[model samples]
Target: MMCETSDGDPGTDGGAAEAGADTGGDDVDEAGLAQFSALLEDSTEDLYDNAPCGYLSTLMDGRIAKVNSTLLDWLGYTGTQLVGRKRFSDLLTVGGKLYHETHFAPLLAMQGQVSGIALELKCADGSRLPVLVTSVVKTGSDGQPLLVRTTLFEAGDRRAYESELLRARKEAERARADAEAARKTAETERARLHQVVVILQKSLLPPELPQVPGLQAAAYYHPASTDQLGGDFYDLFALGDGSWSFFLGDVCGKGPEAASVTSLIRYTLRAACLHADGPAEALDMLNTALYARYTGNDPRYCTVVAGTLTPRDGTFDITVASGGHPPALLLRADGTTDFVRTPGGMLVGITSRPDFITSTTTLAPGDTLLLYTDGLTEARTTAGPRYSEEALHAFAHSLAPAGARQTVTALTGLLEGFGNGLDDDTALLALGVPAADGVGVT
Candidate 1:
C-alpha cells in the first residue's frame, strides 16, 4: 500500500484495497495538501522581501515597478517612493548615470541579460554606494517584453581598499622624490666647500705679478688637484729704481700651514730687500726669520731662488741667490742654451745658519731666462723613466732664443705630453727682453 504526501507524489499508497483499508483515506490526504500549499505561499512572499541581495523590476516604459526591502533600505526609500516614482537611473551616481545611458542600457537591451557589473548608486543622503548589479529582461508568454529585473550586491569594501592602495603608492613616490632632492642638495654643499678652499688658497698668492719694465715676464702654477691647496708660488714685483725682484719657491707640504709659510716667505723677502741690495742679504734675512719662527718639532723648510734684475749700461744685470733650488737656464739669441749653476746653497729653515750662494749674469737684448720647481723635471715617462735635469736642459737648448711666453707655453705642452704621469704641481717663471725697438729677429 502506497500513501500520498502533500505535493501529490505517492509516498505510501492511500487506498489499501488489497488489505481492505480504503475508508476515510481520500478526505485526509486532501486536507493535508491544502495546508502545505498555504505554507509554500507564505515562504515565497518572505523570500521576495528579505533576499540576501537587492532586487528591482522596471516596466516596459523603464519606470520602477517593484523593489525589495534590502535595496530600498540601501537607497533610503519606501515601496511607494520607488514604485512608479523613480527609474533605476535615478538611483545612479553621476558617473554611473553616464555609463548607464552610453553603455549599460544599450548592452542590456541587446544581450537581454547583463550580469555582475560594477556601479555606484546614489543614496537619499547624497552619498555614493558601490555595488555590483546584474539585470535581465522579463517577457510575457506572448513573447512581449514586460519588465527588467536586476540584482545588486554591495561593493563598498573593495572600492575602499583599492582607493587606499592608490593613496599609499602616491605617498611613497613623493618620499622618494624628496630623498633624491636632498642628495643633490648635499652634493651642492660639498661643491661650495671646495670653492671656499680654492679661494683661500688664491689669497696666499699674488693676484698678478707686476709688469717689470723692459722685461717679458710670464709664470704658471699647476695645482696638484682642484680640491687640495699646494705650496708652490712665484712672483715678480718692482724693487724701486729700474730693478725687479722675483722668486720661485715650494714649501715643505700642501695645505693651510704650507700656504702660511708661502705668504711669510713672500712678505719677508720684500721687507728684507727694503734694507739690502745683494741677493745674499735678502735670503739671509728670510732664513733667519723662518728658523726663528718654526720650532724643530714639526719643522718647516722651503727651497727658494731669489733674484734681482736692473737695467744697466746697454745690458741688463742679473743676480741670483739660491737655497737648495735648481739652477737657472739661459737661452742666448743665437739658439744656444746653458745652465747657470749655483749648487752650494743649503736648504733654508733647516739650521740657524745654513749656507747660501749667489751668482751674477748679464743679459743682452735677445736672451731669455727660465726658472722652475722640481715638479716639472721629476715626472715619470712612459717607460718609467724619470726626466733628468740634463734632459730638461737639452730640451730648453733645442728651443733657445724663446721669450717668457713661448718658453712657459712650450713647457706646459711638454708636461701635458707626459699624459697621466704628471703627478705633481709645477711652477714656472721666465723672463726675456722683447724685440728691441722693432728690430725683428724674424
Candidate 2:
C-alpha cells in the first residue's frame, strides 16, 4: 500500500533534510563564535583587576581617574573611595609626596616617562609599603598630556638587605678605630719602659774616668741590649800615697739582680783598696765578701781583674790581680804585645776560698796596658768563630805605638763593627805612660 506523504515526495524530502542539516551547522558555528567572544571579554577584565602588580591612572591635574582592583586591595581601599576622590600623591607617605612633587613630577614632565623610582605608599591601617614605581604620560591626539599611567612593585626585601649592609659597614669601621687606639697605647707604654731602662743602665756605669798625671787614661762600656742593665763595671780612683787603684769586672747574668751584684762588687773593691795593701789583697777581700753574700740555692759568681799603679822615676809601676779573668794585654814601647799571665785563679763568689793571682809590670815611656772583659774576645765573627785572645794579640801588635785615647778609639771602632756578633757587655780600660818628649800621648 503506497502512502502519500503530507507535503513532498521521497526525493524532495531527502533534499529538504540535507538543507536543514546545513542550516543547523551554520547556527552552531555562530553560537560558538559568540560564546568565545564573550569569554575573551570576561578574561581581559578579570586579568586587569587581579594583575600581579598594582596600576593607577591620574588626570593631568593629578586627580585619580582610574585604579585597578589589585592596587585598591593592596592599599586596603575600595575603588570608589580612590577614583575621582583622591590624587595619586595623596596615597603616598609625606616624604614620598614631597619627592613626587619636587623630583618625580618634574622628571616625568620633562622626559614624558620615568621608570624604577623608589617610593613609599601609605595604607589605610597607617603602615607603609616600600615600592618601585614606573609611569608614562598618555598624550591626546593633539600631542597634549592627558593622563599618567603608573605601575608599582613591592621593594620590602631589597630595602631590608641595604639596611643590613649599612649596619655591617659601620660595625667594621668601629672595630678598626678601636684596634688603632689599642696599638697606640701599647707603643706609648713601650717608650716609657725604654726611658726607664736607659736611666737605670746609665746609673750602673762610671760617670767619668779619673785623670792621672803624666799618664793618659780612657775607658768604654757597651751593653748588649738597651732593655736591660748589663753586669760589667769599672772604676779608677786614687788610694793613697800617690798610688791609684782601678778594677774591671763582669758579674754573672743581667738585669736588676746582676746590677745589684755589680754595685756591691764596685763598692766592696773600692772599700777594700782603702784598707788592703796590694792588688791581690783587694781581690781576696772582694772574693770573701761575695762568697759570703751569695750562696745556697741561688749561687752568683763573677770574673774580675783589679790593679794598683804608682809613679816611679820617669815610669809607672803597676800590679794586676785576677780572679778567673782573662789576662791583660800590654803594648810595649817596642811595638810588641803580650798577655800578662795569671794562672790557677778561681772565680769569685763561688767558694769560701778562691785562689787569686797577681802580676806586676812596669809601664815605661810609650807603653800602654789594656784591661777588658770577655765580651770582646768571645764576640763571634761572620764565620761563627770567636774573636779569640790570639786575634786580639795580633791586633794590638799591629797598632803603631799609641796612647790610651787612640787605642780606645781603635778598639771602640772594632766593637762597633762587630754589630750583632757582640752579644755580651764589654768594659775597656786603657792606661798609658807618656813618652819622654810627649810625642804620642794625647
Candidate 3:
C-alpha cells in the first residue's frame, strides 16, 4: 500500500521534475532524492535509539553492533562503551555469564531465539542492574544466521519483594520451632515435678512396718495422684515398754500443707509415746503436745487412733484411744466381726487435751485387727452411694478368716476399684493374730 499526498505528490523525482519543468528540473530531482534518503536514515536511527525497551544487534559471535538509549541509560553506559567493542556477555554478572555459556547460548543457538530471560547487567560503576532480556537471530531469506537482537527490562522491585517474602518465611519457621522446643521443655519439667511429688509422698509413710512379735502385720497405702503429695500417713513403732504403737490417720485436706501436718503428727506420735507409758497415756501426751504445737486461728488437725498390741503369753492385750477416728474392726477365729466403737473424741491439734477416749480389747488366736483411714468406709460408690461403716463391716465379714496380707491386698484392690471416685488418700494397717501358733500366714 502506498500513501501519498492527496495532491499526488509522493516525494518522488517524477513529481519534483513535473514541478521543476518550469525551473531547475535536474537540480531539483537530485536535491529531493538526497533529502529523502537523509530523512529516511535519520528516522530509522531515531526509532532504534529511543525505543521504550532495550534494542541491540549482536553478531553470531555475540558482539554488540547497536544498542538503544533506554538500555544504555539502564546500564549507566554510553554507546561508545558498548557498541562494537563489547559483547553482550560483557554486561552479564559472573553467574549470568556462566549460565549463558552452559545453557543460554547453547539453547539459543539450537532454538534460534530466546526471550524474556532473567539476567543481571554490570554497570561501569561496579554495580549490578537486574533485568529481563530477550534475544533473537535476524536470519536472512535462506534462514542463515545474521545478528542477534535483544530487549531488556528492569527488575529491581520484584527482587526486593521476593527477598522480603523469603525473610518473613524464615522468621515464621524459626518461631514455630522455638514454640515446639518450649513445649517439650515444659513437658519434661512437669514429669520431673511428678517424680518429686512421688518421692515426697513416700517420705510421709514409714520406711518399713514395725515387726510385732508373735503377730503378722501388713499395711497398704494408695495415693490418688502422683502429682499430689498426700496428707494420709501411717506409722508402726515400738514404745518404751514391751508394747508397740500403731496409727493410721488422714489430715483434713491433701497437698503440701496437709503433708506438712502429716509429718508433724508422725513425729509427734513417736515423741509423745516415748514420753508416756500406755496407749491412753500416749494419747494424753499427744493431745497436750499437739495443742501446744498447733492450736491457732487457722487450725491443723487430724483424725487418729493411737493403739498398742502387746503380746502377753498366749494372748495380746490391745488398748486403743481415739481422736475423731473411725472405729477399729476386729475379725475373730469364730468368724464373728465386731466394731470397737469409740465416740465423743475430737480431732487432734484443735484443742488442749481433746477428750481422747480410751478402750480395751483382747486379741486371741486367729483374731485380726484392722485399722484404716476413712478413705475406706467413705469410698464413693459408682451409683454415687456412700460407703458406710456398716457396709465396710459387711465386707469384712465376707472376707472373714483373711490374714493380714490378704486383707491389706483386698482393701487396696477395693480402693483402686473406686477409680477416679476415690479422691482422698487411704492407709490401712492389718495385724493378724499370732499367725496360728507362729506357723505362718493362715
Candidate with maximal TM-score: 2
Candidate 3 accuracy as lDDT: 0.79
Better of 1 and 2 by lDDT: 2
Candidate 2: stretches off by over 4 Å: 1-172, 380-387, 394-398, 436-442
Write model 1 residue lDDT over 198-219, tens digit each, in one string.
Answer: 7976776788767766777878
RMSD (CA, angstroms), candidate 1: 10.5
Clash pairs, candidate 1, are: 1-13, 2-12, 2-13, 2-14, 3-12, 3-13
As a whole number from 0 to 100, the lDDT of residue 293 in candidate 3 is 68
Ranking by TM-score: 2, 3, 1
* Model 1 regions lying over 4 Å from their true place: 1-202, 378-395, 412-424, 435-442
Q: Candidate 2 overall Cα lDDT vs. reference?
A: 0.85
lDDT of all predictions: 0.80, 0.85, 0.79
TM-score each candidate: 0.60, 0.72, 0.67
Model 2, position 418, has a per-residue lDDT of 92
Regarding TM-score, does 1 or 3 come out ahead?
Answer: 3
- The numbered model that scores best in lDDT is 2
Clash count, candidate 1: 6
